[model samples]
Target: MTETAHPAVSAEQAGIEQALTDQVVASFDGTPDPRLRQLMQALTRHLHAFIREVRLTEEEWNTAIEFLTAAGHITDDRRQEFILLSDVLGASMQTIAVNNEAVPGAERAATEATVFGPFFVDDAPEIPIGGDIAGGAHGQPCWVEGTVTDTRGNPIPGARIEVWEADDEGFYDVQYTDGRVAGRAHLYSDEEGRYAFWGLTPTPYPIPHDGPVGKMLAATNRSPVRASHLHFMVTAPGLRTLVTHIFVQGDPQIEIGDSVFGVKDSLIKDFDVQHAGTPTPDGRALGGDWARTRFDIVLAPAGA
Candidate 1:
């Protein structure tokens, strides 16, 4: 018995794919930035390869274009449908990974980075240390305390800590039709590099699904839920700013996988559920059972 050999490509189709890829890449030569030109050329090659590999049809291409157009139309100041699109597709996470990677022989560990979701508002209300940032949102009250330290363990004073999260109901302040802002604030570290504030326990929440990203999720049979976590954007004058979240260690959504692919094991922390009688670090009494979390951030030197 003998096996048949595959046929060679016809002369007409030979090099056609390469020629198209080359032509598209060549068009990027005029890009002013050398890095931009390189990226455009590489992207062109990969994009063309995907089209060819999928044997994409004209109708399918049109549908994709229409989907993107819808995403753009639905985007606005409050709603960032494009970032949501990138998040759900894991592009945002991939870009974060590439840009925030640690060096192989770095002296110390730097806080891991993650996606910055669309809910963040500019100039979130600044609160005093130990003050509540939740603004009486609907959720169990909890204390968030942490220190900002350099790679060598020295405390960094006056580090800006920008925090935000969804309430227990999985709705952020922006989602409220009443135009109220809650569950977000900015605070500064004290002389000891320590910061503490009252915030609601993080709860699993679904990304905005009323837009095109929602349609995409439905079409692909994917959930629009992100894991329970609190977002933080920490920055110090001489250190690299760290944008990340502290995920609930045992949240079921962690196993289910985050819709935005933002969870990292290093960022997972125990949200210690406590009874009402328990005393908080600030000598405050809880109205009921609530959660508590401690996260110490380590920042790398700028340009490191």
Candidate 2:
């Protein structure tokens, strides 16, 4: 029987390779923030592991770098290609999931949060409780009513209920070249935590595919269509602010896939269609066919 010894050169090469990653990790040791130092080291380790596992080619690496560079170049105040990138890749949703835990059994579930798409604007034309947020945008007239309540089913009075969405034409006000603001508004809940507003039934829209995110989706043979849904951002004192969507039930695009992966079964609701001359719940007259949807929201206590 014979015993074999490992080559010294192989061991040396392995140590050298490991040292390269260790050196980078060690460079972050002096970071004043302990959390930052840990994050940097962890990120470095995972990044190196990925590179090593892939045995990445120089050309492929350069292509990736160029792609990222182009993503930065196309980003602007109005167009956030980076956020779009994160969204399409599902990183944003994963981060939200990590931070938003589910309520345990025997307790009411808090409303699920989703990606805050880049189109939301501040000071979105505050309106009366029953006022129209759509500003006569070209879409089917829709009445949206909801109640903001705590997880225990208690009304949260005076909560801010903000709503925004694309029109029937599948374009948000921000997407207009004329700098117009439409299809979005904000209002406060009534004494009973009830909120109501006139808005267009959201239609399926393409997630701005003219930029790097669109290019990425095209390269990967994926669709950029987001499911039809209305965006809501609800806030109240002593409760966690919830950014979510009430998606239209039976939307074909949702069955396909939401580009941002923001869809949840609990968030889906029916947008009932009513014909002309039908009396609305709020006593508003409809000259033509319209849609109506009711979505009640549940908020968790702060830090819940």
RMSD of each: 4.0, 4.4
Query: How does residue 20 of candidate 1 score in lDDT?
Result: 72
Write candidate 2's Cα lDDT for 259-295 as tens digits. Answer: 9999999999999999898898889877899989999
Tens-digit lDDT track for model 1 on 222-261?
9999999899999999898899999988899999989999
Model 2 stretches astray by more than 4 angstroms: 1-14
The estimated TM-scores of all candidates read 0.94, 0.93
Q: lDDT values of the candidates?
A: 0.88, 0.87
Off by over 4 Å in 1: 1-11, 104-107
Query: Which consecutive 10 residues in model 1 have the weakest lDDT in total?
Result: 1-10
